[model samples]
Target: MKTLMKRLRAFALSGIIGVGLLGSFPALAAKTTLTVGAAATDVGTLDPHYATSTSDRTLVAWIYGALVRFAPGSTDPSTIEPDLAESWQVSNDKLIWTFKLRTGVQWQAGYGEVTADDVVYSLEKSRDPKRSAFSADFAAINKVEALGPHTVRITLSRRVPNLLGLVTNYAGGFIICKKAYEERKDRFGRAPVGFGPFQTQSIVAGQAVTLIANDKYFRGVPKIKTINYRFMSNNAARDLAFAAGELDASAGLANKSWLQRTTSIPGAVVDVFYPAELTLLHINITKPPFNDIRVREALAYAISTQKIAEYRGERFTRAPKSVIPSNNLGYTDNAGVFPYDPAKAKALLAQAGYAKGLTFTMLSSQLPEYETTAQLLQGQLEESGINVQLQPVEHTSWHQMIRKDLSPVVIYGAARFPVADIFLTQFYHSSSIVGTPGAVTNFSHCNVADKQIDEARTEADPAKQVALWQEAQRLIIQNVCAIPLTETSQVWVHNKKLNWGFDLKGSMSLGPLVTEQTSFSD
Candidate 1:
């Protein structure tokens, strides 16, 4: 509740900085600056641990560092490389791990040097549910102890499917400056400090968040001196802003029509990147109508994943192979899905005593991806005698409302660390059921696959782990916790002058990443 209040206060405080005033803080002649038009009305939070929105996550990666990180433009876990920790060693049993921290790494804004004590504090904070939205991801950690001023050791209660994934520069893996956080406390959500290439300079609430280059960055000093991450929720407005040369880069719509329209712009390059986000329709089984197995199965039969993929075009979207994303380890189409058949759907509804048809209201997001996906499902389900009324809300409100269990069906789309265990646990494990203690987005209140998910996380044998994950997916599908829809790749349009310092491929943050080598030239 306190966190919610803090967020509200931050938003309220944001109205003070008018958008027009951004011109007053231009970069020096020798330094370069870039303005990006993001698809958001405002930032949810800047603190990496609680940054869930794409807008916030995009900024989090810039302003924070983790023990390790996915290589620039890469989502593959095998590309995991050192960030704050110079090197690490793991015990043969895989429970105990020790890390050697890089010496003399400076923190942003005089926060002092990064040390083992800071790493230990950050890990503990990541483990505390009150401090982190991703605490469940750290449940296997027994403790983090500082062995020396520059060394830290982590002991785990049991082996996690991917320990490095948990500690990478994503989600709760972002390391925080202990002194800065302790000093800021609850206010740290808006004012975060880290050791990344960029530092939070200022936030103008509904307008933009300004970031300045961190000269003391360990990798190297960033070439782009300033970043103006502006909030332009309207697609047309963002496009216009980019066309007017007010934005160097902007978030792009995934549909082919939008792609064709934007590609004609002079010097505008559209980057459709890897590791597509998996969209799903999560049915709250505990809710009336959905509580009946026949009704749940009817929903599966009525919806068409192929149609959803086709809506966005195959170039950037594809039908998901399983409830788990195709790019994820252990993903298997053999889990089995109900084919789209209106006749079968109608029969199932008739058997469930709803022959006349059933009507239900769904609280969905107005965000392009979600709004379109929900409308598609609603139209398709209507043919099978299932009437869905969409109560569209803004993106932020939609996220909060669904977590309150107000939505019978949640149209959620996300890209996590390409791992099956992480996806299955957060979406199907009983422990992750929303509105409960330690919840992490189990919107459906799914519990059937909890056993398999738990066993798979601790399974040491590679083949056995894969089998357990496959079994879990099969169970979740049979029970109809969620119907997998389309997997859509991220799309963004950037100016030709912007150099990202790496070949852009994929980002776990679901957006482009700016690093020390990033710069702009005529």
Candidate 2:
């Protein structure tokens, strides 16, 4: 009887243990879903061509496919590799570029074949001022012609050494379908047509955007069936969502403390990348007080970048001495010209005839970093006898004010690119000056500086062009065009279980995140 009882107990225990093991196996092997959160201030417009803000760019990247995409491991973020375009060659003079399109690539909708004509149309429409695309980064293209079903030719007015780099940029050369764009012009931005691994499922402006797997994508469909991009208004809220497991990933992380706090969690991982964005103080040169170069220089010298970096946590920040970060190509250290000197600042203020000290409104957004920097500047300037009134504004309003050149001083962030042209051209070009209610350039209205910038733009030789850029930088520094502050590092927080190897750079590149090489593990 004892032997029989022992045998029965052993059998029951073994069965129970087996069942427990089976239950835990799934827990260990379950597939992970990554939810990325973005601190979006406003809802993005459905039109990819119309997107101007960084928030819109984040969403557009998933839905749209470019002719050539920036390779993940390239030293230069703007260097191009084959995407829709299999290969490309530039003429000896570098004026003309011929691109050979990849074969067997189809649109997500399977809406007929994608030909070179589609590329031509997309470029043409983007450059068309009538279309009013705020994102016309490729307006410099002289012309685009479809050579054949699989080939396209681009002619430039002037030789662009960084032509290929520009083409791979987020704003310049995203390819779209001609048929779909024409048919769904109104809905295309929300429901974009692309050759990416994912297709747009839905977009609710200012709220969330969703993408689903494109089974027919030439590179093969993404393993993840769906991607949801949720818009949280601020980093604090976004971080909270991530900690709660409501989000898998968060882009443009603004809070270092929160990120550090979350990394302690078992499934959390903090990914730090070199930020492509520079946090700077933009002085309105068109305005009265700031128009004086002396005043601008004084203001620039008043703020201490070293202190700002220290206070903000130096691990994710670096004091930037030039408009372009040191990591970028063609960047030269120009710190000597814009050295911090409180005594010199005060002297300049007196020389500018503001001996009684100057008081002006300094504008910044509600985000913690901007607000903190603004306050820090305020204190620093006050010591130099300059009273800076802190004006904290909403993100949308702040953008508008900066574009209109309404504020005396404004805190701004710019994502750095491989080529210096991207920064110098857009910000300093006279033609790019925003004049109306919603101008993109913030109406700096700098005509004299514009002429010098134009000369640099047309210069073809890389060495010559760089010399010109250096000259331009010196000129801007002399005029105190804008106070270059610091380069803000990009920090990404993710769930450790989802393994998508990505390096932190100045800007976020989505290509690697969606590539086949990216895989998840429990």
Candidate 3:
């Protein structure tokens, strides 16, 4: 009996030792799997053309290819290196552009070779009034035609120097499978087919999305076979999952507490990329009380952007004085429009006939940074004798409320682009406000109309177009349609064991993510 008991103890101890060894190196014990967490509140349509939100663009980029891609170090936003297209040139007149497509690129759906016809078909579908997916962006294109199987020609209605930049934009320009669209036009947006480095394996909306390597990708198959995107409604949960070893990387690590907690763990790193977007308070100028320019100017001076930046720490940049940041192509230092003056704010309020002080609610979502900024602005405005209320709502509800023209003031952020043209055209252009959220422009409804903004749309000269855009910015700031607060940096948290390289300007292109530039350490 003693000998039998000894044998049983030995067996139990061996099993325990084996388990301990396995626990010591989790990476070695299992298949290499990477899980990324994102705080995506809404499920977007899969069709790249129809995707409107930034979160949806993040997913679409992985599934599609653009004709030209922005080179990593290129300072010119308008200059793009070839992707699906091997080479491209513009006519001396700068109105017509021709592209030579690469040979032997296959769509994911086993469709025949991607031809110029596919490019023409994709652009036409995007421009269809019935589609309404990305019509505003492509409205300037007069026509797109297939010169041949390998050559595609695009003619613009006007001289658009930044046409290539527009083509690289994630939402509207992704190449789709012509055959797949013809057969599944109704559901194509739900399940898109593209020729990208990564192919969609499966997606469970608002839960997780899985992507597998595209073996037949033209650039080359991605080294990583699988990429799993897990959705978390907020940063707190995402940070917890990363610390617990369930997630490898996450975006929107804006919370300081979460960053502090995660960085404390071994093998974890925090990367602070340049401000991809800016957060600001938007006032509805189309409505009453706010219609008065004095009231708008008063509100701009009443809030302290510096305080908001200080509270947020290094993650936030000081609110830019101009609508476009200095880093943008046509950014000009225009401080005259935005000056921090409490007394001036008070006087403006009185001038606007609110000597007793104006009271209004500031709407924001559950984002901690936004909520904190709103609270700080509330305090600052109160100090300036303006009564302000901070109204916090769910993200989805907030989006809905803003679209209905119900919110007087709301806190919002928009991702930056290479050119100021994209900013002015999308947000301030009259046509853009019709169907979109208008958050980029914040539906500020400024009266300082610009025919130049319209003329620049068809204008193709780079220098001339930039001059027009600068004028638009000048007008926008002069009118004080929306208060520019701060340019907020994109904070990404990841395990140091994984390697990834992303541009300072956040790009929807997945080349950086797929090229093994982003990898994991053993």
Candidate 4:
């Protein structure tokens, strides 16, 4: 009874919006509501730990606050700023990191203050493989302890100069209330509560998730009182709705047709963002056949960037000049590992005892871009005497199967900030091997330059670290662990009135964050 009273008092203090019905949004005539129609079929998961898609990340942002966050509208590693942790310090050895939290931050559903215990608990869960999919990233933390009610000390296993970025928004940094989660383990993913600017109101299957502004938010409650995040999977329907003014914003692919149609719509803006993501085909070295470097090289040589560029058709992105995008930090302009040469590919295959050509099935996601790229690759490989059968799996299942090492050749699409260490570690570190013990996303299972990667991350000197990171990428490209495909384009079509607070350079948020500044100008 005492515990219940405490909960009720805290709930009253939080100032959460009251709904007459459970799992239903309340009718509010005076509230400002924003309708967002996205290209996702559903809001994937509210649990920050399991979220892997843009839609999932968007929802997480609405209901959870990170320890640190990227500068508004930017995914650059250098722009990391404090969120939950007001200030932090690093010991001279650069191993011990201490963060001081702010007081009076209340968790949704009246769970109480955002204290050091919550941060420690959240980080602990992130490190536990049994609980989080991102355990590999958290494995870098040697130890974490709560110093006081609002202080946290973290000891790193390795000196990571950009440790702030690693723990920022996307790469597993959302702090959660421990008791609230423990009390609702079975419904955790479906219903997550965090000390964020907004609280979830309802999640209607196959439709939308509604959120209400947290009136007691530390940063001041969001001006937009309500948001309906609609899952509009049909591109045509989404576009039509945008024309009809049923949506404030909609997801867009970098294509000509979208431009031709959207340009004429009054009060609509099509914002194109770049260096968005890398598309790559992972070569599983531990698996048979591709385990041989020559076989991998042959496959790389079999890829034709020009052919792929032509096949993709849309101006969405360009064939990658290197594993890292042109603008990415530590991107060295060396000749790409493989030039398109069918003769060279054939020669390598012949030397590798695959002279008659080998056949393999490549697993691809059902997303248009993934499936399209897979088909184009199939054609390119066939031209080089390699026969590839394309198997299209639904998006979620495809991610699951690829991580299990189900396909030796897995076509993947991912985005990391311009930081090369992040890109290299997630895709090549020995510790991150998928389907292995405590695995995360090292689909290639390549350890060719692990030492260089580790050294780059630890080198406090910025210039030296960049050079080392460049060297690491060179080594991985040399090994043909994966073939760099293209960087996809990002386009967001939104109502002109919704002024995203920052300059529209790029967005990590599926739709850039909706803040008090994101108001309807009209």
Error of 4 at 376 (Å): 2.8
lDDT of 1 by residue, 181-278 (tens): 99999889889999999998899988999999999999999999999999999988999899888999998888878888888989898888977888
Clashing pairs in 3: 47-189, 158-458, 159-459, 159-460, 160-460, 319-485, 319-486, 499-519
Q: Tell me the lDDT of model 4 at 267.
A: 89
RMSD each, Å: 11.1, 4.2, 4.1, 11.3
For residues 1-522, write the lDDT of model 4, one tens digit per residue: 999999999897665544334339644444377898876767667878878776777778778887888777776666788888999999988889999998898888878888899889999888787788777676679898999999999999887646786577764777888988999896888788888778889989879999988887888877788889898867788889999999988777555666778888998898777546778888998887998889999998888876676554455677776666666677777834688888999999999999899898887776656767888788889998999988877676777788888989888777765677777777888878887777878888889888988888778788999888788878888988889887776777898877676687765655567664555664
How far in Å is the alpha carbon of 148 misplaced in model 3? 2.0
How do all the candidates rank in terms of lDDT, highest first?
A: 1, 4, 3, 2
- Candidate 1: segments with Cα more than 4 A from true spot: 1-31
Give Cα-based local distance difference scores for all models: 0.89, 0.69, 0.70, 0.79
> Among all windows of ten consecutive residues in candidate 3, which has the lowest summed lDDT?
508-517
The local distance difference test score of model 4 is 0.79
> lDDT score, residue 297, model 2?
85
Backbone clashes for every candidate come to: 0, 12, 8, 0
Total clashing pairs in model 3 = 8
Tens digit of per-residue lDDT, candidate 2, span 1-522: 999999999999999999988966645644534467876656445455666556666666666677877664343554457888889998887889999998778887877667899889888876665554443356568999998999999998876547666556366467778899899978786777877777778777677777787788787766677777787867668877877888877764434465557767768876666534677676678788888888988988888887777666666777778765566555678734577789999999999999989998766776555776778788888999899887778665676666656676767776635566667666656566666422345334544455555666678677877777766666666667677777776666777777664443433442224543344665
